[model samples]
Target: MKLDESLFTVPGVRRGLRFYVTGPTPCPYLPDQFERKAFTHLSQAAPDALHHQLSEAGFRRSQSVAYRPACPNCNACRSVRVDAQSFSPSRNQLRVLSRNSDLIRRPVEPRATREQYRLLKHYLVNRHEGGGMSDMGFREYAGMVNETPVQTALFEYRQGPEEDSPLVAVSLTDILRDGFSMVYTFFDTRQPKRSLGTYMILDHIRNAESYGLPHVYLGYWIKQSPKMAYKKRFQPLEVLDGPVWRRLEEDE
Candidate 1:
């Protein structure tokens, strides 16, 4: 398939890109299922424009690769993003904001640090014991944070505004031309009551609004995946349905 250049205000449309599909792997978020991905490397002269177009096309970036689910028989993995301009927090969500009000958000460079790596290990051990990234080491962690080809930002959430405040959470995000894609986030599990995960998502929406961006890409959400159901809490969401994006209905 070829990308339509008529739909953009940007030039340097990439051409002749190659895409491949991986062999089926056990579905991580669902049971008795398998998954595949149609992916292409983020190799081009204009990486930012290419990244933006692919993201609008429902592809997500990992390192230098852009991919989306291509499970031939199953399309449960739907790409979803929040309409940052129209998002309004629920009562519970507001409480989450209040709880983390003391946490200061600091945007840092993409380079990784030992402090962040140690925090990642603690988060993984408590929250995702046997998941795919449970065994990730510092080297791999650094690569994940630093090997990006496009613009990226790492938000360090601390207990205070001071540079030396206790770090409690970290969000590695992709800054697309039109919005921010939350690539990954990890936090202090010891303060679960702070609802750090929910707080981060809310903060991203707030961040998008402040930047005058339209959306906060939240990656894929599956109706049957309990792990992803929380994404629905963010209203005014748009989901990529095939080649079109439309407002997600309440019943959907």
Candidate 2:
């Protein structure tokens, strides 16, 4: 596909930064549709600041690259963030927290470990079978965790406070100026009742509140995708509409 030079003119984007559009590919979230993306590399010139600016403008970081959907005929993907300061857990969410209260969360450097890869492998096989990341090997997994120009961390969740407890869940997160961006999260699929996925997000909300951050970027949310439906459960969700963010009402 031809590079879209017009995207370089976006405000806050530094001069000389090039942007390119990807050729159309099958859309993962929708049926009988294709998707494309506008992406640029986060070079050393000003990686952190550039990442923050692009993130606020609805781009997501994947390793050292920032990208946003540029589908020609569809705008189904909407960037969503949670208002952490004003967020209140509902009864169900509270229960999810209580259920996994014993799990200990530790913020570690963005380094890949054998345990994490093992958990990721299990998660892919059981939860995301045949998906894009299902067949990822250790080298690629390491790149996902370690190849970042912006500030990033891995929040590892273990069953207990003991130093040797087995890891139960992990979230690869980006530390943004305004909030934390949940780049990706995977958990032990054996314990469905524990609701580790929801718990990880809930923990991030509390973590953001403790850090005095106002928002928690949850990446793209497509209303028609069942896989993305869980994102809406967080109340007072804000979605990027054009250049502005609008709150999603409960009735909508």
Candidate 3:
């Protein structure tokens, strides 16, 4: 395992390099243990290549964000992606996709708004109250939505252009040279019928195809977590196993 020495010269606040290790901390996905990460600056010189390689190897990019596991013994986090060329929505997925047809998606600068924050707050309280981000305040939310170095945008989902207060969902996505990475998404869970989560991914897949990109990098998929199982529904998918992304048979 060779660390890319080039990573040292990667872009960002160039006030000389500094590296530090985290104390053993509980793993987010798995119970009762710790996780650590070795991070570096994300440079524009070779962002696409670096992002592709790092993401393929289980790293997740936040806003200009890039991070990977450096834990002592844990290896549960695995990167996942949807094969845009081969993806075929199931009957249920198609239904969800169709349900969202009334919504208009607009690509806007990646900045937080009052309405968006309101939806995010609702989502957190209803869906993730006991989770870590449950209490994120305005400034924190701003950083999550605003800080970045790569090409990123916010997809606003509204019912109709003329309808006031129509915003129903929002997604933060990175427009990579090769494909797109869905950084985060939050929606009005009150409108569960729309299945906003599924809708966003489907939209990204369609967006990828329009750009001639071949894959949509989904952050991770853990078999045991019901939260992540939905990812498998987007069939003709690939999971990062070791150093390669092995394509799984539809039934496998």
Q: Which model is ahead, 1 or 2, in terms of lDDT?
A: 2
**Top candidate by TM-score:** 2
* Candidate 1: tens digits of C-alpha lDDT, residues 1-252: 333332222234365677777788999988999887778777667888889988998889998888887776677888999999999999999999999999999999999999999999999999999999999999999999999999999999999988888999999999998899999999999998999999999999999999999999999999998899999999999998766789999998
Off by over 4 Å in 3: 1-20, 43-49, 162-165, 249-252
How well does each candidate superpose onto the true structure, as a TM-score?
0.94, 0.96, 0.86
Look at candidate 3 and give me any clashing residue pairs: 25-34
Q: Write down the TM-score for model 1.
A: 0.94
lDDT of 2 by residue, 1-252 (tens): 444444456677677778888888899999999989999999668799999999988999999999998876778899999999999999999999999999999989999999999999999999889999999999999999999999999999998887679999999999999999999999999999999999999999999999999999999999899999999999879998877888987765
Q: Tell me the tens digit of each residue's lDDT in model 3 across 1-252.
A: 343443333333244534334466676677786777666556566665666656555667766657766665655666778889778888998898888888898888988887889899999999999798999898888998888777788989898876364899999988776688898999999998888999999999988887789889888776756777788888778887766688855564
Best by lDDT: 2
Considering lDDT, which of the candidate structures 1 and 3 is the better prediction for this target?
1
Stretches off by above 4 angstroms in model 1 are 1-13
